[model samples]
Target chain A: MSVKLTEDMLKALPDSRGHFGAFGGRFVSETLMDSLMTLEREYLRLKEDPEFQATFDKDLADYVGRPSPLYFAERLTREAGGAQIWLKREDLNHTGAHKVNNTIGQALLASFLGKKRVIAETGAGQHGVATATVCARLGLECHVFMGSEDVKRQSLNVYRMKLLGATVHSVESGTKTLKDAMNDAMRDWVANVDDTFYIIGTVAGPHPYPLLVRDFQSVIGRELREQSVAQAGRLPDALVACVGGGSNAIGMFYPFLGDESVQLYGVEAGGLGIDSGQHAAPLCAGRPGVLHGNRTYLMEDENGQIAGTHSVSAGLDYPGVGPEHAWLKDIGRANYVSVTDEEALDGFRKLTRIEGIMPALESAHAVAYGLKLAATMDKDQVLVINVSGRGDKDIHTIAQLDGIEI
Target chain B: MSRIEGVLKALKSQGRKALIPFVTAGDPHPDETVALMHALVAAGSDIIELGVPFSDPMADGPVIQLACERALKHGTSLRRVIAMVKEFRETDTETPVVLMGYLNPMEAMGYETFADAAADAGIDGILTVDLPPEEADEVAPLFAARNLDPIFLLAPTTTDERIRAISEHSSGYVYYVSIKGVTGSASIDVDEVARKVAHVHELTALPVGVGFGIRDAETAAAVGRVSDGVIVGSVLVDTIARHQTDPKALHQALTDLLNPMRKALDSLAQ
Candidate 1:
C-alpha cells in the first residue's frame, strides 16, 4: 500500500533534501540569495527540532482547530453508485476553509521570527480572509493585495478581510487579478524583507514555499489517515484533492505519497472544456514556464506572458500550478486530471442536495471526480477526499450563473 | 550567429570583458532614451540592454520597477523602445542593443509582428524575464527567424542541469544573477559569486555576465574581476532618479560607477 523511496535513494542528487520524489527545488531571483540561505538554515534546524513541531502542533490543535472530521457521505456515495465515500471536512475548520491551517502555522512562525507585519496576495479571497483572520488573532500588521476584479466579485470576502483589520490594496494593473495581486505582494516583499513575513498561500512559489506550504497543509492527510484507519479499520483505497496552485492537493497527498494503494488524483478546473480557451487546467493544457516565483506548467502566450484563465471557482482560476506538481505529473506519481465547469457545477449541486453539504467551487472539482470515478469502481472500494472549504463564498457566483445545468 | 557571440568573439580575441549597461527607454523623458544609449556606448558599454517599460513587472526589484513605472507613465512602449534602438543603431551599429522587458506588450502586439518590427528597428536581442528556457519556443522560434538573440537568466540557485538546459536554448550571453532574490539588494559575497560563475561557465562558452546586487563601481569592479560582464541596475537607477530634474548629477553618478569598473577590466588584460 506504500510507495516509499528511502532518503538514501535520493542522496545522489545535489539537492536531495529539497526535491520531493521528483518535485521541489530553488528557482528564484538573485535578490533572495542571502534571504533564502538564511531561511534554508532556519528551516533545516526546524525540520529536525521536535520543539518546533511541538509548537506548530499546539497551534494546529489549540489555535486553528486540528484533526478535522472525516465523515461518511452515505447518501452521496449511494447516488454516485460506488463504495462508501468519506469526506475529510477541512471546510468546517476556522475561517471556513483549509487555508486557515497553513495561515495559523505561518503566522505563528512569523511571530517566532519577531516579524511585526504579515503580507500576502489573494486570488479568491479565501487565503486573504484566512491570513487576515490569523493576523487579527496574532496582532500582526496585515496587508493583503487583492486584484481589483476580485475585490468586485468577492465583495463579501473583501469586506470580511477589511473587517478583520487588514490593509487591502486593489491592484489596477496587469489584468487586475490574482497574478497581478501576486506581483504586488512580491514587490511588497522585495521592499519589506527586513521586518515583514510574506505568507504565501499556495505551493506555487519558488523552492521553500512549495515545501513549506505542503508541510503546513499536510495535517489534512495526517488527520484523515488517523481517523479513517481507526474507524474504517484500513487506509482508504484512494486520496483525491483539487489542485489550485496545488497546495491543498499536495497537503493531502504528502502524507500518503508512500502509500501506493492510496492512489492520488488532482482535479483541475476545465472551465468550458479542455479545448476551450477558458480552462484553468495548467497541467493538462499549459506548457512549462516560469511564473510568480518558479518555473512550472502555466497558461502562457506565444510571448510567454501569463494569459487569462477561467474557472467556475475563482480560487482555481489561475494560470499556473506549483513546480512540484509539474514534476509529479512528469513522474506519473500522481495523476493530474481535469473537471469541467459543468462537471464541478453538478458536483456542487449533488453535495448540497444529497449530503446536505455545500462545497466551495474549488473543492467541487474533487467532488466532481469522486462522482465520475465512483461509477467505475466496485462498491466495496472506499475513497477518501478533502472537502477543502465551505461553499458560502461561492454562492453569489453560482446564483449569478444560475444553479447547475445538465 | 547571435549578437552575443560577436561580443564573446571580441572578448576572446581582445582579452576583455563585455561591459553591459542597462538604461530604461523613455526614462526621465522619451528624448533622453536615444541620447543615453549613445552616451553609454561612448562610456565603454560593450552591450546595451534597453529596457522597454511594462506596467506590471513582477520580477523586477524596487529600483527597476520604479524606473519602469516612470517609463510607462511617459507612454514608453515597444514601439518607442524600438525607435530608440533604431536611432542608436544609426551611430553605433557595432555595440549590441538588447531589448529587455516583460512579455505582455510583445504578445499584445503579436510575436511574429513584434519580431519583424524589432528586426527592422535594428534591435539585436531580447530578454523576457518571465520566459524561462523550458518554454523558449513560446517566442524564441519567432525571434530566431528574425535573427534576434533570446537572452535568458541563470541564477546562482540554478543547478548544473538547469544551466545546461538554459544554455542549450539560450542565445545571447546568459544573464547570470549573482544572488537568490529580486533585483536590488546589497553587498554580494564575491567569493560565492566566483564559485557560481565558474559553475555557470562549465555549461556554456556563452559569456556569463553577472547582475543583481552589483550596485556600486567597487562591486562592479569586483564582478568584472571574475566574470565576462558586470550589470549595475539599482545604483544606476537610483543615480538617475535622484537627479531626475537635473541631468548633471545623473552623469556624475554614471561616470562614477562605470569609470572605475572600466579601469579594473582594462587592468585585467594587462
Candidate 2:
C-alpha cells in the first residue's frame, strides 16, 4: 500500500514513538528507556522546525558538499548495453563515505542537546572514523567503540579514528563484532545519559534515530531530485543502492517512495552465495524478530539469538536492517536483490578501469547489480546508481582477492 | 474472586503491602521450583511471578542470567512451565501466578494459543520484558479477553505521558521498577519507587509492584510502606545458583531467603 506522499502530513507523523508500521519502537533496558525518550522528544522538535532544515541544508551545501552531481556513464552504458547508468556521487562527500552526512547532523543535534561526549559504534570502521572526524571538528569529546574482530580486520580505520583524536575502545561481547559493539555503545549512552550522545551509523536503532538518520541522509535523495531533473529532464527509470543496515539505500529510495513509476532496487551483499549460510541477506533468508529495538527481518537462530553473518565488504556484514526497509520490503515498494562477492569485485574493477571512479566495496555491490540489470533493459531507460562511498578503504580487502594496484 | 485476589485485597484493606516473590521455574529442577513457590507463598507471598527461562535475556543481570542458564541446561521451557502451573493449580488456586519472560516464545506459540493455555493452567497474568505498553495493544487484549490480567511495568524514568499510556493499558497491576537498571543490582532507589507509584496511582487505580533491587527485609518493608507490592528477584535466583546440584539445599536456601521478606511483609499485613 503506497500512500500518496503529502509532504505536510507525512512529516507530521514521523513514526510517532518510532512505530514504522509495527516495526520500530522502544524495546530497551530500563536504563536506556529515559535517555532515549528524552532524545526522542528533542529530535522530533528539531526535525519539524524549518530553521533546522535550513541550517542542515546550508551546511550540506557549503560544508558537506550537497547537490552532488549525476554523471551519466556513457562508456559503461554501451558496455552493459541495456540502460543508461548515472552515478550520484555521495562518495565525493568530505569523509569518503556517505556516513559523514548523518554524523555531522547528529553531532550538531548532540551539541544542541547540550551533550559534550559522543559515543559511536562502527562495523566497517567508516562510521567510526567519520564520527570521530566530525566530533573532533565540532570540539566534542569522542569515544569510538569497535568490535574486536572489526578492529583486527580494519585496523587502519581504527588508527585513523585515534588519529582524529578519539579514544577507540574494542568491545568484546556477543559476537565480538558490529552488533556487539553497538550494544556496548548503547550501554555507555545509557550509563552516561547526562553527558553523552550516541552517533549511530545507520538508519537503525530505537525511536527518532531511524527517522533522524534518514532525515539527515535524505540529502542524497533531495539533491537527486534537483540534479536528475536537470540532467535527464525527468526522474530516472530506477534508483539503485546497496542495503546493509540500509542507510544509503534509504537515503536514495525514500524521496522516490511516492513516485510510483520509479523502480527501486536494494542490492544486498551475497558474500559467498545465498547457500553459504553466511551471507547477510535478511530479506531473502530471515524472519521477523526484535533486534536493536526494531522488529525487522533478522539473521536469527532457532532460539532467536543474533546469528553470525558474512559479506566480503565489512559495511555489508550486518544481520538486521533498519525497520523502514523491513516495512518497505513487506509492502513491495522496493525490490531487494543480492549480488555475489565475485560480481561485486568485477563491478569494482569495471567502474575503476572504465569510469575512472574507485567505488567503495559497499557501493560496488550496487554497481554489480546494475551491470546485470542494465544489460537487459532498453538504451533509453535511465538508471540512477548511488555511489555510496569511495573505494580507498576497500583496496586492502580487494587486494586479498586480486591486486587492483595498477 | 480468586483466593489470591481475596488474600491480597484483604491485606490491602488493612493498609498492608503485598510481598510478591519471583522464582524462576525449573531452576536446577522442576520439583524444586514447585517447593520454592509453595514455601514463598506460605512464608507470605501475595502474588507470584515465575520467570520462564530464555536463551538471550537482555534485561536480566548476572544472577538471573545464571538462573536462566541453569534452567535451560535442565530442559525447561514455556511448555514445562505451564505444566508446573497446572500441577500447582490442583492444590492452591488462589495465589495469582504471573509468568514473566520475553515475547518470542509466546508470540511463536501464537498469542491466542498461549493465552488459552495460560488461562487453563490457572495463570493470573504475564509480564513480557520486551513488549512495551505501546506494542502491547494486541498482546494485552489477548490476555484480557481470556480473563488473564496483562501486568505492565512503569520504570523510574517513565514520563507522565508514558506512565499514563502504560496505566491505561495495564490489567492486574503495574510493575514499578525501583532502580533505573536491570534486575539484580546492588542498590534500590526507595524515593524513585515512591514517586513512580504515586505517579501511576494518579493515572490509574491499579496496584503498583516494585522490583529489580530489593535485597533484604528492610528494603522490602520500606518499599511496601509506599507501594501496593514488593517483588524480590535476584536474591532468590542467587539461592538456586548457589545450590545447583543439591535440591534439598536449594529448597532450604529458597525458604531461608523468603522467610525474612515474608516476615517483614507479614508485620505490615498485621
Candidate 3:
C-alpha cells in the first residue's frame, strides 16, 4: 500500500515542529531542546540568504571540487547487456566522499553562529575526516567521537583526523559502534551547548537536522539536474544511491522528487540476508519507532532495545535510518531494497575491472542493486548510480576477506 | 489527593523537606527490588523513584550506566518494572512510586496501553528523561486521564520562557538538574542551585526537587536548604553495584547511605 501525498506535503515538509509525517520530531532531553530550536531558526534564516549561498557555492567550487563529472560507463553497460549506466563521481571530492558537501555547509553555519567548537560522531570515520577537514579549513576546534571498535578497525582515518588537529574520543558505551558514538556526541552537545555546535554526518537526528542536511546536500541533486540535461540530454530514467543514514541518497533524490518519470531506488546493506536477521536494512525489514532523536524505522528487538546491526561496510552498520527516507518510503516516492555482502563484493570487483573505478564498500551496495535493476530494464533506458565515496578505506578489509595479509 | 500530592502536603505541613531516593528496578538482583523499596521507606524516604533500565542512557554517567547494564543483564523490561511496583504496593500503598527511564521502552509499549498498565500497577508518577514538554502531547493526555503525575526535568541552562512552558505541562514536582552535565558528574555549586531554584519558584507554584550531583549528606543538606526535595540516585545505585554479590549487605548499605541524608534534610527543615 502506498500513501498519497498532497503537493504541499512534498514541498513544505517537517512543518514547524520538525515532524515529517510523524516520523521526525525533537525527542531529545530538555537541555538540548533550546540549542536545537536555535539551530533551526538560524538554519532557516541562512538557507534563504544570498550571501550564505554565495559562500557555500564558492567553497564547493574551489575548495571541495564541485560539479564532479557524470561519466558514462560504456564497458559496464556493454558487459551487463542492459540499460546504459551513468556514474555521479562523488568520490573525487576533497575528503574523498559526499560527506564533505554537508560538512562544508554546516562548518560555515557554525562559524556564522559564532560557535568556536564543533563535534561529530563517525562509524567508518569518513564523516570524522570530512568534519575535521572543514573545521581545520575554517580554523575551528573539532572533536570527533568514534566507537572503540571502529577506532581500531579504521585506525588510519583516526590518525588522519588527529593529523588535521581534531581530538578523537573513543566511546566505550553500548555496542561500541555508530549508534553509541552518536549517543555520546549528543551527550557532549548537551554538556557544552554554550560553545559547541554538533555537525551530524547524515540526514538523520532531530528536527531541523534532517531538513538542514537535505538542503545543504541538495547541491548534489541541483548539479545533477543541470548535468543530466547537458550530458544525457535529459533526466535519467532511474536513479540509485546507497543508504546508511541516507545523506548521499537523500542528496541525490531530493531534487528529483518532483520528476514523476524518474524512478528512485535506495539500496541498504543486507549484511547476510533478510531472513538471517543480521542486516542493517531498517526500511526494508524494520518497524517505525523512536531512536536517537527522531521517530523512524529502526532495527529493534521486541522490548524496543536497539538491536545490533551487521554490515561488511562499517558506514552502513547503523540501526536506524534518516526519517525523511522513512517518509519517502511510506509515501511511495522512492523504493528501498537491499544487497547482500557477497553481492556488494561482486559489485566492487565488477566496477573495478570493467570501468577501472574503485567504489567504496558502502556505495557498492548501490552498484549491486543498480546492476540488478538495469538488467530488468530496456537497453535504451538510463540508470544513474551515485558513487558516494572512494574505496581506499576498504582495501584492508577486502584484503583480509580475500585471505591475504597486507 | 494522589499519593505524591499527599506526601508533599504532609511534608510541607510538618516543616520538612522530601527525601526522594532513586534505585534501578532489578539492579543487583531482580527479586530484591520490593524489599529494597520497603527498606528505603524505613530509611526515611518520602518518595521512591524506580528506574526502568534501558540499554542507552545519554543523560547518565558511568555509575547509573553500569546500574542499567546490570539490570538489563537480568532481562528487566518496562513490564517487569511495573510488576515490581505492583508488588510493592501490595504491602505499602502510602509511599508514592515514580517510574523513571528513557522513552523507547514506554514508546514500544504504546502510550495508552502503558498508561493503563502503569495505573493498574499502582504507579503514582512518571519521569521520562528524554521526553520534554515539547514532545509530550501524545503521552501526556493519557497520563492525565489516568491521574498519573507527569514529571519533567529543568536544567540549570533552561530559559525563563521554557521554564514557564514546562511548569504548565508538568503535574508532579519539577526535577531541577543541579549541574549542566549528566547525572553523577561532580562539582555542584550550592549557591547557583539556590538561585535557580528561587527563579523556578518565581515561575511556578509546583514543588522543585534538586538532583543529579547530591552524593553525600552535606551536599544533600545544602540543596535541601533551598529546594523542596533532594533526590539522590547515583550514590544509592553505586552502593547497590558495590554489594551486588551480597543482597543483605546491599540493603544495609543503601539504608546506611540514605539515613544520613534523610537526617540532614530533616534538620534543615527545623
Candidate 4:
C-alpha cells in the first residue's frame, strides 16, 4: 500500500481548497468562512513576498533562538549498542518547545493583519506559553483556553501564562481537555472575528491553519536538512518525533517527505497499553471523521462521538491528529507507532541518566520508540530523535510516580 | 417536490413566514422528544428542525452544548434520532422534519448508509452545521439521490459569490445565522439581518430562514418581517433545561414560550 512520493508532492499538497486528499477542508460554520478566506488571501500574498519571509527569518533567528542544535548522544548511542543516536535540541528553544517556531510566525502574521487580540488553546500549556510570549512581545491582548483538568495538571505553566499577561480560561466542557479547549477557542474566535486572531498551536484546525502552521513549523525539517549535511555528512536513516496534534512531528517531517531513503516515524502516547484500550494512539486505532474543523483520523465511538483519550503525557491526550499526518499514513509515506506509559517513563529516565538530558514526557514517547528502533539497526546506521521540550515542566509528574513530594 | 419545498411554497402562497422550532432529539428524555415534536407542530410551527446531538458541538453556545450533553447522556445516537423521526412520522407526516447538527455523527454512520437510513426513516431535509458546500459534494449527492433536501447555512459574512456557490448545492432553504456568534447569543441587530437577508435574496431564489438569536416574540416578529422563516433554537432548549424535571411543566413552558412567537409571526401576514 506504500506509494512512492513524487518530488512534486512536497510543493503540490492541500490543493486549492486545503484538502490533503479528503483528510482536510474547512468544516467550520458559515460565519468563519469569510474570515478564513480573508486569512487565506493574505497568507497567499505574504507567503510569496520576500520581505515577509525575511521578517519571519529575522524573528526566528533573533527572538526564537533558531537553528537549534543537532547533537550526537555518544553515551546514549553506546548504551543502545546498535545505531548511532542523535538528538534535535528543540528543548533549548526560547519557550522550551518547537511550539514557538510556529507561534512567532503566526504572531507576525497577526501583526500584519492588524489583529490586536489573540486567543489560543493548550493542553500541556507549551502552546499557550509560546502564544502568550509572542503576544506580549507584539503588544497583543492574549486569552488562552485550557481544560479545567489540565489547569490542575499543568498549573505551573498556567501561572507562567498569567505572568506573561495572558488571561487563562478554564474550559469545563467536553472531556475537559485539549479538544474542548479548542472548541472554546473556536467559539471565542467566531464571536470576536473582527479583531481577534486565533493562534492554533498545532498543524490542525481548518484550512489555512493546518497549511500555515505546517509551513511555519517546517523550519524544523528545513534546519535539520542543512544541519545533518554539515554535522553528519548525510541525512539520518530514520527520523522520530512525538505526535500529539502532530505539530512537532510534521514540522520535522515536511521537508523530508520526498527523501524516500529516509524513514520517518511518529510516536503516539500509548498510555497503559493499546490492547488495554487506555491510549491516545489515534492514527493506529482510529477512523476517519470530522472534528475541530478538519476531517482526520479520530478516536471516536461507534456513534461518531469523539472518545475520551488517555495519556500520561498531557500533550498527546487528544482524540484527533493533524490532517497531513493522516494523508501520510494513508499513503504509507510515514510510519506511526506507540509506546506505553511504562516504556515512556523508562525512556524519560534513561535519557536523563545516560545523556545528562531530561526530555519532556511528550518527547519521551519518541525517545522510547527511537531506542527500540536503534537496537534493531546496524551500528553504521544513524537515527535522530526530536527532544521536543525540556523536562523541567514534568518534574512533578515524575516525582509523583516515584512517591516523592516535589 | 420535496416535502420541505411543499411546506415553504404553501406558506408563501398563504403569505405566512415559517416558524421553525429547533429541539434536540433526546433532550429532557428520549421518551419526551416524539411528543415534543408533536407539540411543536401543534404550536403552529411550519417546519420542525430536530437537532442530532454530538459529543462536541463546536458551533453551539452554552445552552445547546449542554443540551447535546444531556441528550448524549441518554445515548442519543444518530440512529436513535432517525428512529425518533420515524416514530414522529407515524402520527403526522405533513410537517416537514429537518435534522440539524454537526457532521461527525452522520459521517460515523457513513454517508450512503445515513442517507438511505434517513430517507427510510421519513426524514425530509438535513442541515449538517459543519459541512459547508465546499465539503458537501460527497454527501450532498448521496442525500439528493435519497430524495433528501440538503440544507446549507449562509452567514452574515458570506460573500455574494459564495452565496451563489452555496445556493447551487442547497435545496430546502438557506439558514442565515443572524449573528456572527454561536447559538444562544444575545441581541441581533434586526436592521443588519434585514440587509444581509436581502443580499442573499439577490443571489438565491431559495427561502431564507434567520436563526442564532431569535429569543422572544418581538425578535421573531421583527425577523419574520425580513425573511421567509424564523428559526428559534437556544431559547426552546433553554426552556427544556429549566423545566425538564416536570413533564407537565415542560409541556406548558414550551407552549407558553412558542405560542406568543407563533401568534406574532402570524400577525406579520396582515
Candidate 5:
C-alpha cells in the first residue's frame, strides 16, 4: 500500500493545532497550554527567520561537525553478498550521537524565549549529556530527569552530565525508566512554566515538539539526501533507522519523504521478540492511546494502564512511540519492523568486527534489520542505515553481558 | 438538575460550603470501598470524589501515587470503581459521587460506553486529571448526553483566556488547583487563593472548589472561606493508606480526618 508523496502533504502535517491526522494534540493540563501556545508561536516565527537558521547551521558546521560522511560499508556488503550498505555517521557528532543536534537547536530556542533554565528527560543519558553540553555552552541552568534504574545503569553518563554543570535527578516512580522520567519532567514543566523550557529528547511529546524536533533533526536527512546523490548518484533503494521516540529516524526520513523510490524502514526494539510481549515495538503490537501529552501508539494493558517495556538498550525501553510514526504507520508510508536483543547483539558484533565501528545497541537494531533487508535485494541496490549514536555508553552493559566484570 | 448541581445549590441555599472528601476506590480493599463512602458521607462529606486507580497519575504527588499503586495491585479498574459506586448508591443517593481519574482508562473503555455505564452506575460527574478542555471535545458531548458533569481543573498558572474557555465548557463546577505543583506538593497561601477564587467566580458562575494543598482543617477552612467547596484528597488518601490492612480502622481514620475539616468549613459559613 503506497500513498502519493506530495509536498503539501508533508508540509501541512501537525496542522495549526499540532495534530498529525488523529494523533499529536496537546493533551496536557490547562497549566501547560499557555506555555505550549507561546512556544508554538515563537517557533513558527523563528523557524522562518534567517538569523536562527544561520546560527543553527554555523553551530552544526563548527560545533557539532556536521555534514557527517555517508561511508560505504564495502566489507559488510561483500560479506552479506547482496546490496551495498552505506552508513550515515551521526555517531561522529560532538556528543557521540545525533541527540546534540536537537539539544543545540532547542537550547538556542530556550535562550530566544528568555528562559533561564532548561530541563530534559533521558533514558540512555546521551540526550542528558547533550543537553548539559549545550546548556553549559549557552550558560543556562540544566536539569535532567533520569529513572533511578537508568541512573544506576548509566552512571558514567550521569557523572559526565554533572561534570558539565547540570543537575541529574534520579526519579523513583512507576517502572523507574524512560516513561517515568518523562512524567517527572512534564510535572516539572507544569510547575515551572514561568522560566523553564522543556527540551524533550525525542520526537514524541505534544505538538510543535514532534514537528520542532523533526525540523531540528532533519539536518541528518537533508545532508543524507545531498551526499547520497553526490556519492551514489541517486537516492538509495531503502533507508533504515532504529526508532526510540523516533527522533533520529524521522530526522533521516523527513527530507526523503518526497522521494517515492526511497523506501523507509523503522526498526523497533524486539527485546526477546515481538511475540514475547516484553518488546517496545508499539507500532507492531500495541494500539493507539493518549500518553505523554500526545495521542499515539502505546503499549497499554486492557485497563488502559501503560505496560512495562523491556529492551537491552535503555533508550528503546519505552512503551510509546512518537505520534508522527503512528501516522506514518497508519498511512502505510513507512514499514515498521523489529529486531530482538540477540539479533541486535549480533549486529553490534558484526559491525564492529567487519567495519571497525561499534554501533550503539539502539542503532544495532537497525543494523541488524538492514543486513537481512540487504541480503534479500540485488547487489546494485544501495541501502543507508542511520548510525544514530556511538557505543561508548553501552560498553559496561556489553561487558557485563559477556561475563566481564568491567 | 444533576446531582452535583443540586448538591451545590442546596448548600448555597443553606448558606453553607460543601466539604468533599476523596479516597481511591479499592485502596484498602475493593469490597470495603462502599462502606468507606458511607462513612465519609455520614461524617459530614457533602460529596465524594471516588478515585479510579490509574498506573500513571502524573498530576498526583507521592501520597496519591502510592494510593494508586496500592489500588492497582488489587487489580482495581474503572469498571470495578463504577461497581463500587453502584453499591454505595444502593443506600445513599443524596450525596454526589464524582469519578476522578486520568483519561486513558475511559478512552480504553470507549467514551460512549464508559459514559453510559458511569451514568448507569450512579456517577454524578468526572474529573479527568490530564484531559484539558482542548482535548475534551470528543468525550465532553458523550458525558453531557449521559447527564454526567464533565469537570475541568483550573490551576494557579492558568491564564484568564484559558480560565474563560475552561469555564464555558466545564459543568457542575470547576476544580481550582490551589498550587502550580502536583497534588500533595506544598502549602497554599489563603489570601492568594481567595484572590484567585474571586477571579474564577467573576469569569464563571459555576461554583469553584479549591484543592491540592488543603492538608488540615485550618487550611481547608481558610480555602473554604473563599471558595464554594473544599476538596481534601492526599491527606485523606494518606490516612487510608496508613490503615489499609484494617478496613474498620481505615473507615474510622477517614472519618476522624474529614470530620474536623467538615466542622471547620461549617464554622466558616456560620
Candidate 6:
C-alpha cells in the first residue's frame, strides 16, 4: 500500500480506481460498494455541470460568506522579525471554520442524490455544527456521531448542533475519540445506506470522499491564489495549514500543487512531542496502513491495531491522515511537520494577543509552526497561515489549561 | 484440496448443512482459546471461524467489539492467534480453521509473510471483512499461492454482476451477510436470505454460508434449509462474556449453546 508515484502522475492521480499510488482505494464492506459508486458517478457528473457549479458558487457567496479575507498580520509579522506573515481568514466563514465549505458542497450533493437524511462523524464539533447548519438550510434530517470524550469537552458545540436540529449521538466505543466516531458513523451509514448520505468531515475515508471533499474544499486554495496575487503581486513564498484528517490543509494546498515556487507545509498535532510517542503525527512517525477506508499513514501498534493518539485539539486527534497528504509527503511535493501541544497553545495565545483574532486549536498548530518557519526566514520573504476556524469554541479548554474558573 | 473445500464437500455429500461457529481468539484469556476450540469441535462444529481481534471493528456491533477488547487486553496479536491454531492442530487436524478479521493486522504482517505463517500454522481460509473484491485483487494471489482460500462476502445489496465478480475472486464459500447492518444487528428475513442465496447459487458453484443475525437453533435451521452452511457468532461471544469468570461454565455454556444448533443443522440432512 506504500507505493510511490512519480511527479507527473501526482497531477492526475487517484487513477480510475481511487488509488493515489497505492493509497485511497475503496476498502469498505460490500454493502457500501453500490452507494459509493453511485456517489462517485453523481459527483463526477455534477462537478462538471454548469448549473451545479453556479449554485455552489452562489451558496459560497450568499450562505457561507465566501472569499474569506486574506489579511496581512502586521503585528505578528513584526513580532516574527524575519518573514512577512499573512493569514488566510477562513475563520470568518459563516460557521466560523473552513469546514462549512465542504459541508455545504456535500449537503448539495446529498440533495442532488435525493437523500433525505445525512450522517456525519465529527471530532471537535465544528464539522458537526457546519454540517447541521447546512442540513437545516436544506431541510434534511441530520445525524452527527461524536466521540464521548469530545462530547464532554466540546459541550458548547454539542448544544449548538442540537439548536440547529441535528441529533447528536455520543459514541462510547473504542478510545472514545475521532476514529471511533468515524467507525460508528460508518456502521450507521451501512445500516441506513439507502436513505442516508454520509458527509465525511475531512479529506479522508474511501475513494470518492477524498476526491470529492478535496474538490469542494479546493475553493480555499483557488481563492487564496487570486487573493495572494491581488495582495502581494505574486504567490506567497509558502503556505501553511494544520492537518487533522488533512482536509483544510489539502484544501489550501491543492490549487497550489502546480505552482512550483510556493512551498507547502502541513502541521500535525504533537501532543507531547514526536519523540514522546504520544502524538497524532502519523506522517511523521507512523507507517502506511488501511483505516476507515483508505490506505494512508496510520498510527498503529506492531500488531496493526490502531493506536490511541493524544492532542489538546480534538479535531487533530486522529490516527490516519488524508491519502493525498500521504502521497504529497512521499513524492516530495510538500513538507509535513508536527508542533507540540505547548507550542500550539502558545500559537493560540500569540495570534489572539498580537493579531486580536482567535484561531481554533487545530489551526493554532499551523500558526505555531508558521511562527517558527517565519522566524528562520528573511524579512522580505512572505508566508501565509490558514486560520481555519475561530477559537471561541476552545475558550473552555484554554481556561481549564490555565486553571481559571471561567 | 484445501481443508475448507474438503469439509464443505463432505457436508454437502452427507446432505448435512455445515454448522460453522465463530469465536474471537484469546477472549476471556489467551490460555483458554485452545480449550474453547476443542470444545467447539467436540460440540460438532464443522468449521471454526476464529476472529483475530482488531482495535476498530467497524463492521461489528458492541458484542464483538467488547470481545475484541477482551482478547486484546490479554495481548492477543495475529502471531499469537496463529500459534493458538497450531496448538489446536496438534490434536484435531480435520476441522478446518478460518481466520477472520479486518485487513490491517494481516497487512502489517505483509501478505506474503502472513500467508506463509498462516499456512504453516494450519489456517485454511482468510476472511478480511473490510477487503472487498475491488481491493482484494492485490492480496488474493498471495493467499492463493499459499493455498489459503480467500473468502469474500456477499451483502444483500450486492448485485448479480457483483456476485459473479466476488465469486470469481473467492476460493472458499462466499459468506452471505443476512442483514444490511453490522454483526448482531436486526433479525434476519429467512425468505429474503433464501432468495439471495438461491440467486448466488445460480451465479457460482461456491457454497453460500449465511451469517450475521443467526442466534438460535431455530434461526440456524431456517437458514440451513436454504444455504450450504450457517455461520453463528455474537450470541456465542455474548455467552462467553456472561460466563467469563469460570472456565468450566464457559466451556459448558459454549457446548450447551452450540449443541442444539449442531443438531438442528444435522437434522436437515437428507
For all predicted structures, in order, the TM-scores are 0.71, 0.87, 0.98, 0.99, 0.99, 0.98
lDDT for B219 (candidate 1): 77
Give the per-residue lDDT digits (tens) of candidate 3, residues A49-100.
Answer: 9999999999999999998889999998887789989999999999899999
Candidate 4 colliding pairs, count: 0
- Please give the CA lDDT of all the candidate structures: 0.79, 0.82, 0.91, 0.93, 0.92, 0.93
Q: Clash pairs of candidate 5?
A: none
- Candidate 2 per-residue lDDT, tens place, A306-347, comes to 678888888888888988888888877888999988888999
Q: Kindly provide the TM-score of model 5 when superposed on the true structure, using C-alpha atoms.
A: 0.99
- The residue-by-residue lDDT of candidate 4 on B1-270, one tens digit each, is 999999999999999999999999899888889999998888888899999999989889999999999999999999999999999999898999999989999988998999999999999999999988888879978988988999999887888899999998999898999998989976899999998898889899999999989999999999999999999999999999999899888888889999999999999998
Q: Stretches of candidate 1 above 4 Å error?
A: A1-24, A403-406, B1-47, B52-56, B61-91, B98-270
Would you list the clashing residue pairs of candidate 3?
Answer: none
Encode model 1's per-residue lDDT on A161-265: one tens digit a residue: 999999999987667788888888887775566788889999877566777787799888888888988988888888788998988898888777667678888
Candidate 5 error regions (>4 Å): none
lDDT of 4: 0.93
In angstroms, the error of model 1 at B64 is 7.4
lDDT of 3: 0.91
DockQ of each: 0.17, 0.27, 0.74, 0.90, 0.76, 0.86
Interface RMSD of 2: 2.9
Q: How high is the lDDT of residue A335 in model 6? A: 94
**Native-referenced Cα lDDT, model 1:** 0.79
Q: Number of the top candidate by DockQ? A: 4
Candidate 6, residue B252: CA error in Å?
A: 1.4
True contacts kept of 3: 0.61
Candidate 5, residue B12: how far the Cα is off, in Å: 0.6
Give the TM-score (vs. native) of candidate 4.
0.99
Question: Least accurate stretch of 10 residues (summed lDDT) in model 4 chain A?
Answer: A1-10
By DockQ: ranked, best first: 4, 6, 5, 3, 2, 1
Q: How many angstroms is residue B57 displaced in model 3 relative to the true structure, after the best TM-score fit?
A: 1.3
